[model samples]
Target: MKNSAMIEACLACFAACEMCATECIKMISADHLRCIALCRDCAEICALCIKLEQRDSEFSHDVMQLCVESCTACAAECEKFAAHHDHCRECAEVCRKCASECQAA
Candidate 1:
């Protein structure tokens, strides 16, 4: 059974991603915008997957795969922008961890 901790962590990550994405979108430079969008999408998918896993839904397998891939992509994108932003670095670390966990699912 998925515990509350996993969900909480994922939710926190989602929030961080959203915040980072929003900040990136407002920047004058367009460099990190795509990366930020990817991160936001990845975080959202992870959140959905976590919720499904907690419910033990039959669709959890498919959702987990999607979430894992999204996180992997997000982590890669974050790595590209990490040097430019601390939030990107932080998001990358979290996304990597989340990717690993999703892969295990």
Candidate 2:
């Protein structure tokens, strides 16, 4: 597993995104909508990245790149409300780490 570290990072990010989305849904509002959407998207993409990386798919590189983009966008969106939301802060942190890992991978 050459991408073992990246896979771990994606797993953590996926979990964080899920948690963040769940929290955002509970506190749904106009401002939280984008965060919620991004979290969901990020989580889905991370899952796909994990599967692709695990099997060493031919499309793993492309999917990892997409994951990087998604994680970056999701992290930025989550950071907006990080001041008041613990979940957002935590998610942002994980997303950032995942983005870096994916990019390096």
Candidate 3:
């Protein structure tokens, strides 16, 4: 994407989400299931948004909107586990940043 900040944010968010999902999967409790799903969805959406932006697709803006929503949702989910999970805290931070960048774009 031409917007470097948004692009970087998305990339960072994607990586964070992926890492958080892996950590959640390794947990013994079922409480992490929802967080895992949200992280996975957020990661995919962030990646897709990056690709769409790179291609300069006509629907990129629309896709970006969805990306923002996904990030927001992921951030909320991650925040619930942030107190105990360092990965979730990091993921939530990145997702929030990405969502802000997407909204600005």
Give the best candidate by TM-score.
2
Q: Candidate 1: misplaced stretches above 4 Å?
A: 1-9
Alpha carbon deviation, residue 44, candidate 1 (Å): 1.5
lDDT tens digits, residue span 1-105, model 1: 575545655666687678778777777577886787797797778778777878898998898788778877888888887888888888888877776766665
lDDT (Cα, tens digit) per residue for candidate 3, span 18-94: 99999999986699898999999999999998998998989889989999999999999899988988999999999
User: Measured by TM-score, how close is model 3 to the native structure?
Assistant: 0.96
Which clashing pairs does model 1 show? none
TM-score of each: 0.85, 0.97, 0.96
lDDT of 2 by residue, 4-94 (tens): 8898999999999999999999995988999999999999999999998888799999999999999999999999999999999999999
lDDT of 3: 0.93
Candidate 2 residue spans exceeding 4 A from truth:
none
